[model samples]
Target: MTERIVVVAAALYDGDRLLAARRSAPPELAGRWELPGGKVERGETPEQALSRELLEELGVAAEVVERVPGEWPLKPPYVLQAWRARLLPDSPDPKPLQDHDELRWLTPDELWDVNWLDQDVEAVREAAFRGAGNCATSPNAPAPAPRQNPPNS
Candidate 1:
């Protein structure tokens, strides 16, 4: 079986807002919004690849906060994964230096306003929850808790 191509997407957050970018190249995906990222190279870890991609595509230094907790399948031979990322404190504001033509920082209430690439919807939803402080639907709903590892033996 062919090895699946590994790709990474960054749900870049600035406090309660998440970043989204508009694709500018590749006729099929152009005009659709997606989290900024690119393929992981053979020798690089996903985090390294994501950092490199963010630098190359958005012109900023980023630090991966955490993986978004799921794997998403793309077209055959490709699988996409997501991570929470943030710009370094001293890094310049991100710009669309490649891949994308526009960038927007979206508040949680504005998450559904953009036309996202279909494959990205679920990942975006999860990222939105993280940004919105674990938005619980009902007052009685249990508040979301951060994952904790079992106590050391």
Candidate 2:
């Protein structure tokens, strides 16, 4: 049986920049850089889950703009749904609200610089090609390869 995994990320944008978090003490996987998000909760839609996660992780509200692309049925059994969001024009300043350490507004050129969680790497790769304008395109780009280097190689 395929283990179903779903993650919903808030594609937070401030003009040409997008917000990304460096996960510090993530409950499971710490020290990874991921877009602020979390697993979809039971009985909740992906959008609802995204909003909740944004609030929980960033101490800010997320008004979803559009569903970004680059989703796939991945190994480790995950089905991801990403969303675009407009941080309120006068959004209150963000505070460290969760396990993630720091936040940054990253441009497309800097997208690949962070070490990403296995599933989120594809989402990051897609961001550059899709532009920072929040295009609600489908999964037009190829998914990223699974981490297959022999353990401790």
Candidate 3:
């Protein structure tokens, strides 16, 4: 598969709960879970793409925290950069607006509970869990720690 530089956000609300999006029907990993963001269009700043994505996919605009810097450490082709964003209190009800089917709030303990995009698995391990479920209610969800590979001879 072609890996591309995607800009996703580990969006959170009330400071502790993360926002996860459920993919639409018949997705490669349909009914699976993922953070609410997407690929960074050319010429668009990672920050801009993230903000635009949230609106396009979830129907809400959020303030970019500009915390995490640089692209996430993934193999070439699938280069990605993301940030921690805070949803405004005035945020709209985030119903799935595009490829997504639903939205949810999950804690660290619950993050690894579902199948995530191959690239996003590591992010969940790194991002700290802030709060418990406040809105998570879907068909399902879990995290597997990264495995270390033995050095080749």
* Best prediction by lDDT: 1
Best-to-worst ranking by lDDT:
1, 2, 3
Q: Write the per-residue lDDT of candidate 1 for residues 10-114, one digit (tens) a residue.
A: 999888788999888887877778999999999999999999999999999998989987788889898889999999999899999997888999876666566
| Top-scoring candidate (TM-score) | 1
Return the lDDT, model 3, position 146: 36
TM-score-based ranking, best first? 1, 2, 3
Candidate 3 residue lDDT tens string, 1-153: 764776666444544667777777554656666677777888898788888888888888788775443356555675656577777779886778888766777664555555666666555444443222333322123446433331121
Q: Would you list the C-alpha lDDT of every candidate in the order shown?
A: 0.81, 0.69, 0.63
- Per-residue CA lDDT of candidate 2, range 35-113, in tens? 7888897899888888788888888876887787768555577676667776776667666688877787777555545
Looking at model 2, how many pairs of residues clash? 0
lDDT of 3 at 23: 73
**Alpha-carbon deviation at 102 in model 1, angstroms:** 0.3
TM-score of each model, in listed order: 0.86, 0.75, 0.71
lDDT of 1 at 43: 95
